[model samples]
Target: MTAASPPSASRPRYAVYVVLVLMVAYMLSFMDRVLISLMIDPIRTELGLGDTQVGLLVGFGFVLLYSIMGIPFGAIADSGNRRNLMVGGVLGWSAATAVSGFAGGFISLLAARAMVGIGEATLSPAAYSTIADRFEKRKLGFAVSLYNMGVSLGGGVAMLFGGVLVAWAMATAVPLPWGELTGWRLAFVAVGLLGVPLAAVMLLTVREAPRRQGGIKPPPLSALWALAMRHKAAFAAVVIGYSILVIAAYGAMLWAPVHFARAHGMSPAHLGLAFGVIIGLFGTVGLAIGGLLSDRSAKRGHPDAPVRIVLASAVLQFPLMMGAYLASDTTVALVLAAAGMATVSTIGGLQAGTLQILTPASMRGRMTAIYLLVANMAGMGLGPLVTGFVSEHLFDGPTSLGKALALVTAVSLTIGVALLLLARKAIIAAVLDNDRAEAEAG
Candidate 1:
């Protein structure tokens, strides 16, 4: 692990500020990304959509472009001005989200969502590369996980804020002021418009953190391929193994509220507050504990602490998800789901932190991009679609959703754990090798 460089040592306050700015962008991005879930019912009625189409809208539509664009954007982040890249991304996604308000049918809405994905593809890889440079290795896990607080918070705020908008739309004396938009349309417009000022703040206030890797052209895919092959086991463990669990994570994120609505006879207004608090508090706590545990374990001279913690989290997630999805009572299900949320959320950012330890500074951005490309495509892109397919085709009636979720949870987590176990030895070796190289360089 390298010591804090002069810029970081002398400008700790500014580093924190930059992290906060990135976090705001991350939070805002997620808010736009997931807000549609709260209005699934309204959107479905208006657009004449079924469960499969809804799944496509929230999952594939966004993730298609998001996954594909990651590597290109990641390469730019490695050698170009990352802050400016994000400025363009924020503005692009915000505008796309606003355009979602004008979508009248499936094709139009899908296009808008795809554009949002294209913009958001630029965020995480750039942000991860920057964090790796700004924080010392000792603090890397905590800093990355703290930045991931935006994820939990953004998801929670989407529901809570969407609930308010839904309530207002319901209580309106007449049509809304602008274009007579109501319900979900107004929600999209409101959240989308927020990006303008955030992009402004990002462009004007956040300075591009100095790249520790030095300004050099990024290696091409041929080189990155060779790099991954060298650490194939560890890479597979972190990427594919974790992606299996991500299927459950993204699946539940897309469908949990809808499950309660269809099966337990709950309304979005009530479920919003209930699940919002659960995801925000429990999920955030899970990330904090994961970062702390990994950092503390690393301090004790375990270089693979992050990988170990992620595997443990994935193991814990299975039972909780099964119990939640199969529970008979609504209160019991929410309790179990909250527990699962905590368990699954613990895996957040830890994988990226592990990669930071393994990859060279010059290629961290592209590496992170590769991780996201696979993880998001497999997990975020497919999770919702898979669940929807199972429910619509295999199961019957409304309550079938819970059963589908339970089945997916059972399979994904079990395989994910086994794969991670296999990767442990390889990760340990790689981490040790990286540590020696970094020490020699220092």
Candidate 2:
């Protein structure tokens, strides 16, 4: 059930092509996912929604269907055509986003967002599994980091694009082929259309990578359960620890622009340009740093490099992240926020690469499914929702958002650090033991 190393050799040129495709795919999904953040105010105004409703639309609604559907999709990725799955996901989510443009009320918008979740649910598991098949383990951290840059790229682009639209819409409705629409609605429709060509590119250009199972039978629920039981500490560290951390990370991310807008009296266009550059430049740099550090440390006899990097990043991030929320000066907050985001962004790809090291090839997709279920559901789902609830209901309404953000972030980061520490010794032991066993077998 252990992972088998392929014959060691230089990586092929096509591997680069594959990573590019997956990275763009990752970017496309994020653009669709985050375009709403810039338009939250307009969406609320048009839909007659409150903060809680916004929380449901952006946070829980997407993660609910995404987490539920990911399990079966994960299994299919293990045994089916992952490239096709990616194509279907792109098409489905793209169409759903277009539909979101036309939604008359909260219920309809929520439904459309749910389908977006379902489509996106197919991506990470399938993409990661395919990457594992194509790249050698040594280079994998870098490859994954490159792919994960989509978060920054996609998010940055969305903010920038939505900001332009927002400024324009404030002046006049965007002229569509049929008629006209508000900036927020038009944002949804515009992002949705982008996926059509991407889906076609995926189908025509990218070929499926072979599975790395070494003749292992198709993974079943029993196998997945057994895998979880076998690596409880590591899984707990990654799943629970990271999820807790994401409460801080993703919540801060979702609300950051609003903080700038409400507290600092900034425009959407300004927030977009600032954050887009920060995310595009700094976030990408951080991902590269994490990957290089991980690979180099592993080469220097630290098999637990990925987790180690994440743990260190967590400690360094808390102060910077909290400072972003608490700082009085807008410029100071943005500077601190950029630093915070770099550290926050470092963990995603490296952690996924680390888990691949831990899991058997046969179970990578399902294991990822489980990881995403807990991580996305608990992290992305509750982080923003709880932040909003505390801000709106528990604290002073709306004005207390920064304070609410700091409290949530501070608590979650602390717990996350503790969990990662718990995971460390277990991970080191597992890696050394596996290496020894593999050596003997060879």
Candidate 3:
């Protein structure tokens, strides 16, 4: 079934409030997801883990559960109350992160991380669906871009907070009821506790926008499958193209700090601060800029603005990333890395907003779920694991991390550009068809 426009004229002033809540929720999940990166050394020392094990803990373990659960949670979001799903998700991930602080060995820690992924899996599909319901299609690019800033914000804050949190935990030697909770353990416990209040805020302050389906019952799974089959070309392009971009993103995100430390001798705290500011400042700016450019371009008759922007970003990202990895001077490397990150960060918001624009309202949640299931599973599952494997096997030692990163990013970005270009004509056709259908319905 085709989508009809929501009565956007009656959208409440409180819609912005909903975006704020989701943004904070997005930030909370990311903090939990990335805090593990900062704790790698302590986790390795205490758990007697190797690079592969640590990669599994950070990459595949969490994402495997997240990808599997996204389909069900997405279906739930399509048919049920999204706000409640988000509340439950926030609480579940928060609790799991705190539980991770108490894990005794690799097995237990892996289990806890898996739970965290399950909880986080509930967020994006629901949040994106809600934003689509509340905002008009014309403004979706900017709105989704604003919402996606949480990703970079959460990641940056995690790195910065991890540095401070680690330093404080090490200095004070905080005693806990369970045991001597210091270093990485304290970081997990401290960050995990932050979500409790945020969850409460989400429950008390946010209201689910009425579903766009109105009195129409959500279509059956078979019908939904038919709809997906109808739009297979567009879906293939978006899901595969975006997932490929994420490979480069996750690879860089998971390993950039280690690269800087090994190659340039920057300390963790300094590296964290530098990257935190770069990702938080430049990444946010890039998302906003991309969204605005795409939105304005659409207004000027470019129906495929989102995909075009992604293609441009992919083009810019490869060269900058290669430069960052290959550069000898620390200052030059950082400048190039920051530019590369700004481009990389644009993909999340643009792809999400674009998908929302292309899919029907009834299927937005499930379609988003399918996209996440494929994108996260492929990107999060392989990006870090591949980089780590290269570092451990192909390279003589850890110091060759820059070379490994360069090779992975160069390949992924190139593939991503190809897929997006292939998807472009399909995306343009979908946008035009939706416009014609909406006009006819009106």
- Per-candidate Cα lDDT values, in order, are 0.84, 0.82, 0.83
Which consecutive 10 residues in model 2 have the weakest lDDT in total? 1-10
Candidate 2, residues 333-418, lDDT tens digits: the string is 99998998899889766868877877766778888888888888877799889887887887773347787888889999999899
The segments of candidate 3 whose C-alpha lies over 4 angstroms from its true place after superposition are 1-8, 437-442
lDDT of 1 by residue, 277-351 (tens): 767778888888999999999999997999888888887888888888778898989998898888777897587
Candidate 2 matches the true fold with a TM-score of 0.94
- Model 2, residue 76: what's the lDDT? 91
| Model 1 misplaced stretches (Cα beyond 4 Å) | 1-6, 170-179, 215-217
Candidate 3: worst-modelled 10 consecutive residues by lDDT: 1-10
lDDT of 1 at 305: 91
lDDT of 3 by residue, 79-196 (tens): 8999999999999999999899889999999999999999999999999999988877778888899889898898888777667877887676667686687778877888889989
In model 2, the Cα lDDT at residue 403 comes to: 79
Report clash pairs, candidate 3.
none
